[model samples]
Target: MNIKDYLESGTLEAFVLGSASAAEADELQQLKVKHPEIGYALDAIEADLEMIAQHMAIMPPPGMLERIEDRIHELKRHPVAERLPDQLRDHGQRSEKDKGQYIEVEGASSHMRIHKIWRWIFAAVFILGKIFLGFAIYFYLENRQAREEVKELKREIRQHHTIIGQQ
Candidate 1:
């Protein structure tokens, strides 16, 4: 295929992704042997992807990498079976009490008693958990995206180098 046809078919992107089938790889290999231009195109595509990969890498969330590593180890040690059909419980029931009632979702035992300190403590924990979770997600995404951006920048630099060398 001509350059336009080749690029239009999305084969280059797949090749860059290393997602091309074995048949496609063999064909491309043959093309590379027959034409220097094809090799140059492949190099350019690789350069672009290399840039993307570089840009996507950034510092991961604090303790997240360690936690992930630990989880992997745990998985290896004990393979877990997938459990389906989550536990269903009635939420409509209410215990007759004073003006307000508190119910424990799931625990060994639960009893309602008025206590200002316990309410504040629960609220504080909830808020902190939300903040921690939010930052963890944001950090991971930013780190990954930064790696891709760096890769793109490097690819542009390489392109410039190629052009200047040609000149």
Candidate 2:
């Protein structure tokens, strides 16, 4: 029989899986017996599919399995604790006096990071404020110069009118 034609027809899929009818299975067994190549093809397909399945399976890291099991048990026992990951966790895993020190270190690290961020924020505000202040000063100086020019023009006009009156 045409093995290539049979595989292409998708009949081999059902045949390989034993999903074929009893008569079809018997026919496939006879074909396998006649052609060892058919058996090799089936074996290769199974191996390839198994490899693909394994490649797709991404197992979680260590302690994740235990955590997942704990969560499952938690859902059954204490539903409320499941909501809070921090509260449910045991600090007993931590040392006694050192736990406080660790807490302090964590707090300090967080606090320092916060302070550093704030410092940058404050510096940015200060720089922006200085820019605005400089703009205000520039506008103020411009307005003052304009007022002085107006006064000078008035004085010059007054002088010209006085000379005109004298003439």
Candidate 3:
């Protein structure tokens, strides 16, 4: 196999991009060892890809890294176990009988608090729903009355036709 043709076949690029099949990767590894030119070509392709990645990389916001580091430090100082309530932390000390017992938790307030704007929006939606329901009922009654009038007119027309036929 021509090394030049093999290098130009894009196998190196596929391998570097992690898209090469296992067999193709194994062949590449063997070829890379036997031929210095294949290794050089692979290295060049990798360097080119790295350059492209560096050029396309986006810079994070200024304080983003510092904020992430600070968060990590805070978590390290307080750990998850330290943050748990005293009752929850004493689980291991409880006997088998006490293990089956449930822990009672108390909250400061039973009511949920939402944004003030959301309350007004919900009230508006409720009023609009009532208005739509009233319109629906009104239209339904009107349609029923219209149907009754149509039936009465048809009956009268039938009777007039019958009387004329008799004459």
lDDT of 3 by residue, 47-66 (tens): 99999999999999798898
Candidate 2, residues 9-115: lDDT per residue as tens digits?
65667776667798877887888888887788788778877988899999888988887886686567646544434423553465454444423213212222245
Give the count of colliding residue pairs in each prediction: 13, 0, 0
Worst 10 residues of 3 by lDDT: 104-113
Winning model by TM-score: 3
Model 2 residue 97 CA deviation (Å) reads: 57
Please report, in order, the local distance difference test score of every candidate based on alpha carbons. Answer: 0.72, 0.74, 0.86
lDDT of 1 by residue, 26-53 (tens): 8878877877777788788889888988
lDDT value for model 3: 0.86
TM-scores across all candidates? Answer: 0.36, 0.34, 0.47
Q: How many backbone clashes does candidate 3 have?
A: 0
Query: Which wins on TM-score, candidate 1 or candidate 2?
Result: 1
Per-model C-alpha RMSD: 34.1, 13.9, 13.8
**Stretches of model 1 off by over 4 angstroms after superposition:** 1-11, 18-26, 56-58, 80-167
By TM-score, how accurate is candidate 3?
A: 0.47
